[model samples]
Target: MAGGHIEGWSPESLEYLDACPVCGARTGQELLYHGLRDKFQVNTPGAWDFYRCGACGSGYYNPRPTPESVGRLYEAYYTHAHTAPLEYAQLSLLGKLRRILGNGYRNYRFGMHERPASILGILAVWLMPDQRALLDTGGRHLPKQPKGRLLDVGCGNGDFLLFAQRAGWEAIGVEPDPKAVEVARARGLTVHLGTLETLHEAPESFQGITMNHVIEHVHHPRATLEHCYRLLKRGGWLWIETPNLDAQGHARYGENWIGLDTPRHLVVFTDRSLLRLLEEVGFARIERLPYCPLCERVYGMSRALAIGASPHQSPPLPREERVLARQAEANARRRPEIREFIMVRAWKG
Candidate 1:
């Protein structure tokens, strides 16, 4: 799994960088992981190298896939799956109750007027903090705006767009993958088939822009942030969720950490590095959002990788591993930096 040319890729398809893509510091870079392969997909050939930037505390891949060849890695990506939304009529009695309660809470918190919702959902959601947090995340923690347009960048299959549209925002998406775009369009979503730079909308056209697990995949993250800043209206917000390089999972699992995601995730950011980048890009009032309940899934996937098990196969996690994952998640509430993912919300001044 190390030191071989990737299948269907030539030497020129890779690009080597001498400096940190985040801070442009070359001297303090340290090799974090060497000969990392596509453990999850097991589709891409050849091993890759990951390095940490001492200056900014970010992680990145060197001799990474160039923009031209990178598309090959996503040919069988998860975004291509067009999962149909669950219908209310298909739910069991308890399932329908939970849905109604969840919808009720969403209406109360996010101003959505979902049918079959009851005010009791607020109390029910409050009783279950994890469910409340999940609802907040599903809404992107956005407060009720004046029904302005929301842009979802790298919007895989337009899942969030549908949610935002139902929540009363004029939701649109930008997706680069043709298969993903086609799937989203099939769902009657408005999606542009290109990157953010290729979007023909006027500057400051959106009231809010969201990028979920999308920033790390881009070739130029700084430029991407700058573009997002320009695309948002004055006083608008940008929400970003990406794998944290300084995560506790990375510390525990090392190269087997799912966040390493070789070749696909070109750059991984620590909280400090990401906050600095947002400020540098002219974003004001930048704030770190609370971590969600994803430790079990992240740890489970990392554990599967450690045991040479493909996560896509849905390997069963042992009871001990689940307990440890829960412990890690509880610990993250006190030590937020140890969270598996970095969630950030920044505002355009």
Candidate 2:
């Protein structure tokens, strides 16, 4: 970062970030990223080095800013929740639910080129077959979504919350980004301006929680998960999504895999290592969902764009590749992948 800190950065200011977040144990050198903070690149600037506990595999962001420093970065750039209204809430939840329940979006249901594939993709996600039988999703095992008091940590623009809201659950979000918070609030949802470590929780309170793509950014993933465990009611579900380290994406692009957005996405998880971390942390009933083509597309494009294309622009996929994505979504729905990966689901039993 300048071999120097930013406006609010101070030496020893955020030294705590370097240790294993989940276990509070000292860690060793882990994966490092250089383009995370490059404004003009796919990722931003700052050389990011993540640390992992040899004992528990709990990872942390070392030489990383303390929670407060992370707070400042988030405050400056993220305002989705407070931004001008995007009418996001108006249709997302019901739209998603209809896809979940059946029928599809009211306005776009009849016909559209993308609609069929999108509908197929949606059906594939919500109704994937497990061992030949359809699997129940969204943790519907609960009685009435349970007023679950769900928390979407780093709930970007509250996209997930929009659905949780329509499901009639009490959903609250905690995001370090003010811009995202602004946009979420603009959608009529309440969100807090802060990071997970800075959040104040009423112990043993929530029925279920989700950390979609948020785990990788925390300095201490284990500690963060533990905090989540403590906050949940016994047997509560904690659904989390993050990039898989073992994927071909990293092999194909090395440090440039848009997935490795350093400084921000500090820790990466693989199925094997992730399982060990979960078991060590007290989670059970773990499962890995198949990966979507979006993972490769997004990361590859980000990497390609980082060198030349606009950072905000998504990398273009060939027409044939796009068609393949649709087919993958459809087939994966009917049969889950044996290799390609996605989200990891577990229970805090």
CA-lDDT, candidates in order: 0.88, 0.58
Question: What lDDT tens digits, residue by residue, belong to model 2 across residues 1-349?
Answer: 1133533346755563434555444545344343245333323335444444565453334566666566544544433433333343465865655443332321122221222124444454345444112222333222343466888888888876775666556888898777787788888888888877678888877888888678877766778888888888887877776766555555545555555555566566665666767788898678764333354355436456446665456667667646655554455445432223446667876
Error of 2 at 109 (Å): 17
RMSD each, Å: 2.1, 7.2
TM-score of each: 0.95, 0.68
lDDT of 1 at 25: 88
- What is the C-alpha lDDT profile of model 1 across 75-188, one tens digit per residue? 899998877757999999998998899889999888888988889999999998888888898788876767799999999898899889888999999999999999999999
Q: Candidate 1: deviation at residue 100, Å?
A: 0.9
Clashes of each: 0, 34
Residue 289's lDDT within candidate 2 is 49
lDDT of 2 at 306: 49
